[model samples]
Target: MRVITVEEHFHHPEVGPRVMDLSGPPPIDLDADFSTFWRNFTPDRELAEQLAGGRLEHMDAAGINIQVLSHGAMTPGSLDHPDATGLCRQVNDWLAEQISQYPTRFRGFATVPLYDPKAAADEMRRCIDELGFVGTLTQGTFAGLFLDDPRFEPVLAAAEELNSPLYVHPGIPPASVLRAYYSGNWPASVEFLLSSPAFGWHAEAGIHILRLILSGALDRHPGLKLLSGHWGEMVAGWLDRLDEAIGWGHYLDRPVSDYYRTQVWITPSGMYSHNQLKFFLAEVGADRIIHSEDFPYVVRTNVADFLLNADIADHEREAIAHRNAEALLRISPL
Candidate 1:
């Protein structure tokens, strides 16, 4: 069976040196710049290969056929540099070159300068039309602002007009959020186990996607395609409770489930739990779910075996593995 992994990650190889070279350094905190995720990434030979050309070797080792890669998420100060717009173009073009090298085995989502929404949308268009990218992926808030803001309407409008999907990846909580809930210094191992990204990012992702729903962005562009990973950041679990607003019938034009079922897609990146997958299937149906490995982050390469051995039937497994991603991304099956 063809296995298309949608939650793969990459950082622009030039990003670090480029950021360090910026003229006026931006504020380094999470009020806007929250990259507890990628700020500290240091590449070894193995990591370098994964970020660049040698990705195919690992995919072959894992027995996966194709991978859909995206930059992890944008932190506030990342693109706040004077040369940010140019950097966005550079990253998107570099990804296009990488995909062009192995058009069959790899494809990528575009990275935009989210600090400027119009520039972001314009780059999104350029990636999709000019570079042949599948779509665009961003994570968390836009400089501490959610997508519902009118400033982002151009981005949403472009996604609708161009038929490009927008993926909301997980992001870290802001400084205030971390200070309130995840504050305190423990040993490095203890922080990694407790507050690092494992617990905080998933909740942050879950909340961001939900905010889009409650903030009525979905209602504006009903045709917009949005994606969430890790079983929708646990949206399936909390969806019903969120729908309690249906009792009053006061706020939304439709129930939250309607928006989720019709507008959103979910992937199980690095989450191989059969129970969680089963619950997502029951709640959102197989069509809205897809398969992903989250790549180097969760670093277990036996996903083909896991999906093949999952308790679900052959048809459902196949749908999650390739069918849904094929339809959404327009990639042919291997």
Candidate 2:
């Protein structure tokens, strides 16, 4: 099957620059050998040989178009890594270049420095207006402030104005939390997966998103779209609990599920459980679920197979593999 891979990933050769104070403790050794780190962190050769090379053979093998997000390149250490304005320009320029290279098979999501909302908004505009990017991808939090912070209103406003979505992927936690996680000799490999969007769901990310909803951001700008990867960090399972809390008059005036179904979408990246997928679809609806492969770092061959072989009807499969992402990105069918 020809699949429109909306959530494919690519790493920049240089990802060490964009690191912020929020990524938790520096991975064990700040001075670790760069060459070895790059080899492990990047997906260039592997991805090229595997999916890009058409290595996985099946009669109905799924072919994917890529949408490159950031690797670790924009980390605080990268060359063009700017304070704010410079970062935006660098990312916008990079996205424009990607579009030029893969005009048809590739699309890009802008990586902006969320630490500064004004800078983020400007970069998003440049990426969308000039570079033709569908949306922006950002680490879960900037500095210590999560996305729900009022400071991010400008960025969200800009996205709403442009009718573009904001893709929120996981990043390391703040320095304090990093210390706690690291003190246990917890491997980042295991910890990052276990902690991410799920942790964010309970901690700052969920709070901020809830606040955003209650603050009327979605209501004011109905066109605004948001994408959460890692199956919304397990948000599907907890919606009812949150909804119940809200119904019992906790923080917001209305039910939290109302905002979720109306304004938010989730990508099935690491989530492959069919029952879970069905559950999410039942709760959030299929139109809001898009296909994602955490990619490179986590090879997506299995996910591709799972979606292709699933027992769902043709329309459901099509909706998840391509249609939903197209709608969110506003990309016309090819």
Candidate 3:
């Protein structure tokens, strides 16, 4: 069966100039210039070499159609704030252009100006109507507000109305968090992986998602689709604990697992372990899972091999490899 790798990722070099303005004196190293670190950290030549060596091709051999999520404006400084509609327009144009280049091999997700809900909503409409993007991708938190903030209601509402999925990926750390890690001489490479799972995934992603659920966002917008990265960011493992917490008359008013199973979907990007995949499938039906390589950050060849060879039933393997994403993205079967 042909598979659609719905969670592949790519970064645009122009994202640096388009998202940031470096005219002013470089602020602090950890806080202000972290964007520079991320941009410089991943060398394009290395990525090109991998792709050229048939690494990505191997995934194609496994019947996977790569769906690339074009890198968008990273927030920090004067570059491209979420409230900047003009910047969003430019980014949307870039994403559309990227998709056009590989119509069969790629599809795109839009980045909207999240600082302003009206602007975000407007840009989302344009991305869907004009650019034909599958959905919009956002950071776990924007500026300082979590996804559940009332300010973002319009953006969420628009996505639901348009039937577009919302892909939430990890971004830079908050100022306070960055300070602690930097002062401790912590390597970002290490800190990012650890913090994303330990802190952001649980505190920010989980809490915000729960807020959306309890607030009746999903109940109101039942068609809303949410895609999370890093194998659901440990959400699968937390289900039983979450149920225990909720059952014990904890903070959440409803069963946490209900929201997880019904309203959200997760991608197997950056996670390739058989046990992890199996756990996610058992906890949140295989249909809620999608395939992703977190490419450019992860070695594509290794991921393709892992997914293809994982010890799962043929049907479940096919579902995670491509079927779930196709259904979620509304992409026709190959």
| Candidate number achieving the greatest TM-score relative to the actual structure | 1
Give one digit per residue, the lDDT tens place, for model 1 in 241-314. Answer: 77885537678878888888898999888788888878888899988988888876666677788788889888
For model 3, where is the 10-residue window of minimal lDDT?
72-81
What CA root-mean-square deviation does each model show from the true structure? 3.9, 4.5, 4.0
Where model 1 places Cα greater than 4 Å from the true spot, the runs are: 20-54, 73-78, 188-196
lDDT per residue for candidate 2 within 1-334, as digits (tens), equals 4465555555433333343433344443333354455466555654532233432331124456544454333343122234555645654575467558657666777776665678778878988888888887766456666666678888888998998887766665665665565434444444443344345323544454665677777777778787776666656568898888667767665577878888888887656788878778788887888887665555555656777777777898888877887777877776
Candidate closer to the true structure by TM-score (higher is better), 2 or 3: 3
> How many residue pairs collide in each prediction?
0, 12, 3
- The local distance difference test score of each candidate is 0.74, 0.63, 0.67
The better-scoring model by lDDT among 2 and 3 is 3
Q: Which candidate do you rate higher for lDDT, 1 or 3?
A: 1
Write candidate 3's Cα lDDT for 78-184 as tens digits.
23354356766666686578567667777777777776778788888888888888888876566556667788889889999999888877665565665564334
Q: How accurate is candidate 3 locally (lDDT)?
A: 0.67
- Best-performing candidate as measured by lDDT: 1
The parts of candidate 3 lying over 4 Å away from their true place are 22-40, 45-63, 72-83, 180-203, 250-253
Q: What number of backbone clashes does candidate 1 have, counting pairs of residues 3 or more apart or in separate chains?
A: 0
